[model samples]
Target: MECWDAAVSSLSLALMVLAVAYLLRQTRTPTRYGRYVPADIRCCSARLGWLVQEVPSFLLPLMLLLLTEPDTEQPGRTRRGTGRKLLVWTFMLHYFHRGRPVPLIIVLSAAIFCSINGFLQGHHLLHCAQFKDTWLTDARLAAGFLVFVLGLTINIHSDHILRSLRKPGETVYRIPHGGMFEFVSGANFFGEIIEWCGYAVAVWSLPAFAFFFFTVCSIGPRAYQHHRDYQQRFEDYPRSRKALIPFIL
Candidate 1:
């Protein structure tokens, strides 16, 4: 294996291992954010916190693209390189759209996660991935892209359902209905998990796959917690619904 490949694979593997540890930790003690924020914890403006924590994931890839030049002397290699970079940038673009009151601890931890993931992904694109001209025509890529689009549609629709459950300035939580919510309490989480899984398939890179594993371990617990919380808080919550998946999880 090439040095970059070996390094990326090793790093990705390490991330996956850490993700397992994180999963165990989260299982024992759920993350303390959203509705579960601790009473005495420090807090930050959601807008500012989100911007700061999430920017690294966006900026690092951009810098990698701008500051580094491809092997332009080899025209085919240059095109492939640019393709990888574009895909990497696209992977992180969705993070630009979220903001709410967040715990300072959450912000700090998320910032670290974002920075590590941003560097791992961006650097992998810059140094490791190599695509041929026919990659665009691959059937698997097409299928993966379709899955990604589907997941994104589901995610967006589910978000709308959740948001609509509450009127403006309403602090009470209501059981979300419609869309994927009919089947899973964490329909939004389900969609996002599908989104990243599809992205992994599209890239067919170890780094991307590792990131998917990390995404699952990281957010999967949160989704289950959400499910349990809903069941406990609302006696009328749909009994048939699962946690992060439809019919199973």
Candidate 2:
């Protein structure tokens, strides 16, 4: 099959998934106060209220960075359908729950950027549909999948450990252990960075590079904040663990 034909096929699948998600949201029932918010969202919002409060603190800086970015040059290097699948799964598992403003903003921003870039790259792939898929492309895709899976594991495992830690404790600020917690204060952020960096390698395009750049720009400071908090909150905090990396900061 032609490259254009395959790209179109993949993009069609992505659009279908989006349609399903929209329909699901539309079909959800309203609550007693006439709010359409789901229980999971409410729970998440309550749990992460402090994070919501912190969004405005970084808004000005983020806007400046995004506004000055350039467009992709070699868009054909990106795979449309596969990227969308990764994004859709990310939202379904991680972002679908109702959280406070920070998480909601993240989901919204991610959705917008992913949709737009995916379409642009997909269009490029369709335009170059006559090109053949080489063994090198297959290898890149496999590598991308492995990186994404590893990232997913890191994210879910760390989150589970943290959640479990909070269950039996009444303390508002408690240090967590196990999983990647022993290596980095922001293991979850590290996982997400890994995920996007892997994406950049897989797509091997300017758009993916931009996405990873944005991810790092956004999460890097948060990791630093958490690292500082850990040191201040616990006198016994390990000095060996870096902010976001294992042994290197």
Candidate 3:
């Protein structure tokens, strides 16, 4: 079991490295989604795509939580109690509820990726990760939880801002203003990145770190592309704003 877990962790790390390489190439050439939606690709409704992609993130974790048994008696395994379970569930909830309109292919690919990630994270947290209830009171966990909550709030708010940008029957893209958009073109992506970083910090596990690494690799480049697109489309786009970072990058 330990060997299997180690293998999975190694595979996750490898995926993260590949994601970084892919991002390097993608930054030069954006994917065909969002503003760059390809004419050739057939896409379904955004809401449907979102549900298809994100539902597994929530469901798989919940299922794993219900099915798995923690290794409380193991010599090296720390007994994570309700606090750790709550943290894991919180992560799952973020994906379960959040929705965004995206291309069919994009959502399909995301669904596949996230399903695997959800299983790995859920399995690890429920059956593999060792945490004590008292760990919740630790400075690292407390700080990380606060950061996670803040990031989740920013992410949801940013999404709301984007959705509210277009009024009824409006299809044209507009400059997103207010909130973190004042500082970054991809405020939602930035918020997500922060959220996962906090998750990694709070969990302090290899799987969590791998998840965070993959999130940065995947979302960071997309944010860069969005920033470029905004700059090209809107001459009045904020010059001070960065891509994914607030005043940096």
Candidate 4:
């Protein structure tokens, strides 16, 4: 493993710890609403060990990336910290505001994955001068930056819309009417998928691709599940919208 990859692997451990801590804090809080997750959406605990196995998902890739050959370098290497910082802020705000455990853990997992992988990808530009002359690297980096920004923007905006839709005593769920919700039932999922996909392409590495594959496998079904649930729950739900994709399923 290169020094950079090794450092990221070590950082991954810290991230896993943070995820556990977030879950602990969320589980302890009683005032936090557990209403966001629908009963139907949750998998049975016996079948849902994957939720807690996110650490291994990340670690396994980190291990492989450590063992694999580095990707070829790209031109005009510039580290984009702006998107990363925005993600950090959004992640902190999500947990700080909601005592809920699930979203908190998801956010932590995403934060750690994006942040650590991003740092390593960006750091490569500083250390690998030969990679600075390739357009592929530049395009990948740009895509990754866009993914991070767009993903967080969609996530925060969608959550805000949903929260506003919540009435004090309401039990049943209502349709989220604004923003990307109009285009797809799972714009948040779409944003997240795009974010990781971009990251995978940017790094062009197995670890990044592993993360992307896991995300798509996990969240893609979720979007479909949410889409079906919304249609069943609301008669007036948008009929034109797909699950995760915009025009196509």
Candidate 5:
């Protein structure tokens, strides 16, 4: 378990570094589906792609959570089974609603990546993480939970806003207004960033921290790319709004 944890942590850190490099290059990658889909790649139905990619996130954790037993005697393990269970459920809950249409390659890659992540997180929490039931009452936990909820709401609402921009047959892009879009160009990305940060704080585990770092590394660059694309595509795009964060880049 220790070896596995160490390997995952190392991989997460390496990915972060690669993400940083990606940001520095500023070359828009084809990973962003929908309006930004690459011209060369043959695409498939978005709904099917979403299911293929995101289902693992929901299922892998659930399976691990049900099958694994906790190690209470481990040095850093929290003694509260309830807290751990709640954390796992919280993690699973987020994945349950995450399906959205995307490119096939993107879905496949994400599915593969998330499968490993789900296993790492679920296995860690169920078998290795040591939290006490009393953790539920901790101020940190409460604050983090609130932040997580807030982020989730923002993420879902932002997606809705984006989706509503297009009518049934319309393919044109429109400026998204209302909600966090009024503040940040990548409101959904920002919300996801906050969500994972809150998760890291609430769980306070190496795996959780790794997951948070990975989220920032992966999504942060995409947000920047989206911001750049929007600015280039629309002459009247808002100049005041930042990319991933409101009023700050």
Candidate 6:
């Protein structure tokens, strides 16, 4: 392997390790954001937080796309062509998960996470990935694409369901119904997990796979915690529903 390959592999492995650490930390005490916000912490407006968290991920890929040289062997394809494709599709996805005031620590940490992910993904795609001319027709790619679409749909719909639950001036948290919430307490998290898993499958790269692994480990506990919260909060909560994965987790 070249230096780039070694670096990326190290990054991928590091992400998985971080995932384990995050899972353990979150399991003992949940993240201090959203419903679990601590009594006293620095915070900022949700809009500003979203912008900060989302911009690095978006901009890094965009810059890579603009700066990377074209692949000489491919006639028209640039080194970061795949990054461009991803950026366009992902731009819309980033805007969906807005929220109330967010803790400053969470916001900054999330931004750093996104930035590192953006760098890893963009760099690998630009420098290391190789594809046959027939890659578009590869069964794995096609199947992964379908799965990614399905996951994205579920994620957006689940977010909608959650957002719709609370009306203006309503301070009480109501049980979210409909969508994947019928089957799993953390439908949104589940959808996100599916998205990254499918993304890993489609990309078929070490970085992508590591990202997927990290995503599962990190969010799986959060979903379970949400499930536990629901059960404790409402005695009438659906006992049949799982935490994240439908009928399983």
TM-score of predicted structure 1:
0.90
lDDT of 1 by residue, 1-249 (tens): 122666677889998998999999999998888788877888888788988888888988778767766544353543334456657766776676565678887898889888888887877777667677767778877777777778877888888888788887898999998889999988888888888888899888888899899889988999999999999999999999999988987
Question: What lDDT does the true structure give each of the candidates?
Answer: 0.81, 0.54, 0.81, 0.54, 0.77, 0.78
TM-score of each: 0.90, 0.57, 0.91, 0.54, 0.87, 0.90
| Candidate maximizing TM-score | 3
Poorest stretch of ten by lDDT in candidate 5: 71-80
lDDT of 5 by residue, 1-249 (tens): 332667656765765675566465545463566667767766666567767777787788888767665453646436436677788888887875644557677778888877877877777777655565466788998888778888899999999999899889887888899999988889999998889888888888777887888788777877887888899989999999889978878
lDDT of 4 by residue, 10-100 (tens): 5545544544554455444421113445445532231133334233333433444344454443455422233333322322222222212
Superior candidate under lDDT, 5 versus 6: 6
**Per-residue alpha-carbon lDDT of candidate 2 for residues 1-249, written as tens digits (9 for 90 to 100):** 123555545554554455455344433521111122344552324346433433332332233223423323344443333343343233223232222233454444444544544443434332332222352457776697678678767877876776676545354667888878899999988988887677666656444455566567556656766787689889999888889988888
Model 1 residue 52 lDDT score: 80
In the order shown, the candidates' Cα RMSDs to the true structure are 2.6, 13.7, 2.1, 10.5, 2.7, 3.0
TM-score of 2: 0.57
Off by over 4 Å in 1: 1-3, 72-82
Give the distance in Å from residue 76's predicted Cα in candidate 5 to where it truly belongs. Answer: 11
Error of 5 at 232 (Å): 2.0
lDDT for position 245 in model 6: 82
Q: Which residue runs of candidate 2 sit more than 4 Å off their true CA positions?
A: 1-131, 135-137, 168-171
Cand. 4 Cα-lDDT: 0.54
Which 10 consecutive positions of candidate 1 have the poorest summed lDDT? 71-80
> Which pairs clash in the backbone of model 3?
none
Give lDDT: candidate 1, residue 68: 65
Off by over 4 Å in 6: 1-3, 74-100
